[model samples]
Target: MFLDPLATPGFKRTLFNAIVAPRPIGWISTINAHGQTNLAPFSHFNLVSTAPAVVMFSCNTPADRAEKDTIANVRSTGEFVTNLVTWELREAMNLSSFNAPYGVDEFELAGLEKAPSLKVRPPRVKASPASMECKVLRIIEIEPIVEGDTTSHVVLGRVVGVHLDERLVDAHGHFDTLRAEPLTRLDGDRYAISGRTDMLGRPSPRRD
Candidate 1:
């Protein structure tokens, strides 16, 4: 069935999010100016560039609340880390998604270990197989269509440092996807892990 987005109520957003299936989950962590730590998982996140190593994530404000802790902390300090979620850390990552009060330490609440980052104030998840420490490059605010409705802000960050577990690296210095076993979010509460069938390679371009 075809429906116009302007006429449909919430259908457009629902369909759009679903159509972008199997998005990489970014378990983002940050620290406010007061040293208050916060953690949250965002599915509206992806790597945007590699030249300067940039990644972006969109954070939407709830109906009655202001921006989320992740957004607030990033705005305050201009730095955050995108911790890769694996199957083993799924439970702790899920716990971080809860709407906790300000100054709450999600790392402690979730019972996960924090690894000191080389280039950022916010620490990375020790259980994460890979994590990227980034500094905020820009925060683009998406204007709301209705009044009193907070907009979604897209935060772009430049990766300054990267941390990876040695187990996930091959002798050739290549990352092993099987070793990582990264977890992805599907629609609703469903999640999935990449399998061998998901692997593909592109043929080299012909110079005729």
Candidate 2:
């Protein structure tokens, strides 16, 4: 199938998301200026850099209404936390994405516990194997989907602190991802877990 993006109107409605399957889910948590907590998940997320430790997530901007609760919260407070979505927490993570009204406490709605963050005001998922507290670095607005309909915004955050489950860490300080069973989004409602996998090592340049 030769999918020409330029010819296909609303190309995203086609195979854009499906082709980018198995995206790591970033279960985000934030607190509004009034201290109201909110939780949501974003499949459009990934690590941006490791030197300064940055992560990014993208979300749609409602053209006719206010921004998403999570986005608004971070804009107001300049902080948020990225909670790892593991297999066990998948259900809660799904429920927390509900389009609830403003000031809704998603933690209570999802029946999940929260843990204090060291360098940020937002709390982390207590049950998550890992969480990264971040400070907002920039929010870049992308071109609108169709102009006056909806738009997308990319958020770049600098990881200020990280909380992890000690059991998932080895003596060499490597993370045991297989043991954590991190969850990922595969297109639509389908999802996947980091289970068994093959391994390979990079060849040394000198070996040639």
Candidate 3:
């Protein structure tokens, strides 16, 4: 039930992502220096600031590699887009998570169309109901808990532009969550649809 990650032998580096229960998935899209596109999902992502609209996603460096394509691309281009994953795009979202090679284009890999972003070079997910076009503010690499294991690159960005589905908005301009049906990451192979765990439970489809 309780775990001290630093002291526990053979403790998983990724278990905390599960311990936190369901987490919002940042379906990040980025383009490398050479313009090769990349998309990847990170559960360790959330809005860190409100007024200036900032978000952060922790990208763990693979044990066998120096960094991931997402981290490298973000570092190279200093821009990225966070696409909200919905129930409709769950399969495509899962497909984009495939561990392809460095130059692989996940958009095409997922068989998803791309929409031009307003303020950033990276394209937004056309099928996604919402997308945040962000410019990198900072990237911090944490010290590894297990000494030998390289840690995560915490990439922070300022949301400069937002794309929202007009139909999902209300008279008051509130984006409907239930209508979006966003997907959240859970432990292991599990994933929970948005509005399921947080508002207790709901019958039918009503925004809480």
Better of 1 and 3 by TM-score: 1
Give the total clashing residue pairs for model 2: 0
lDDT of 3 by residue, 115-157 (tens): 9998999999998999999999999989866566677799999
Provide the TM-score for each candidate, comma-separated.
0.92, 0.93, 0.89
User: Which prediction has the highest lDDT against the true structure?
Assistant: 3
In angstroms, give how far residue 103 of model 3 lies from its true place: 0.8
The TM-score ranking, best first, is 2, 1, 3
**Comparing 1 and 2 by TM-score, which wins?**
2
lDDT by candidate, in order shown? 0.89, 0.89, 0.90
lDDT comparison, 1 vs 3, better candidate: 3
lDDT of model number 1: 0.89
- State the lDDT of candidate 2 residue by residue for 5-103, as single tens digits: 657665666266788888999899999988899999999999999999999998987544568988888889989999999999899999998888888
* Global Cα RMSD, each model: 2.1, 1.9, 5.5
Clashing pairs in 2: none
Highest TM-score scorer: 2
TM-score of 3: 0.89
lDDT of 2: 0.89
**Runs in model 2 lying further than 4 Å from the true structure:** 9-14, 145-149, 206-208
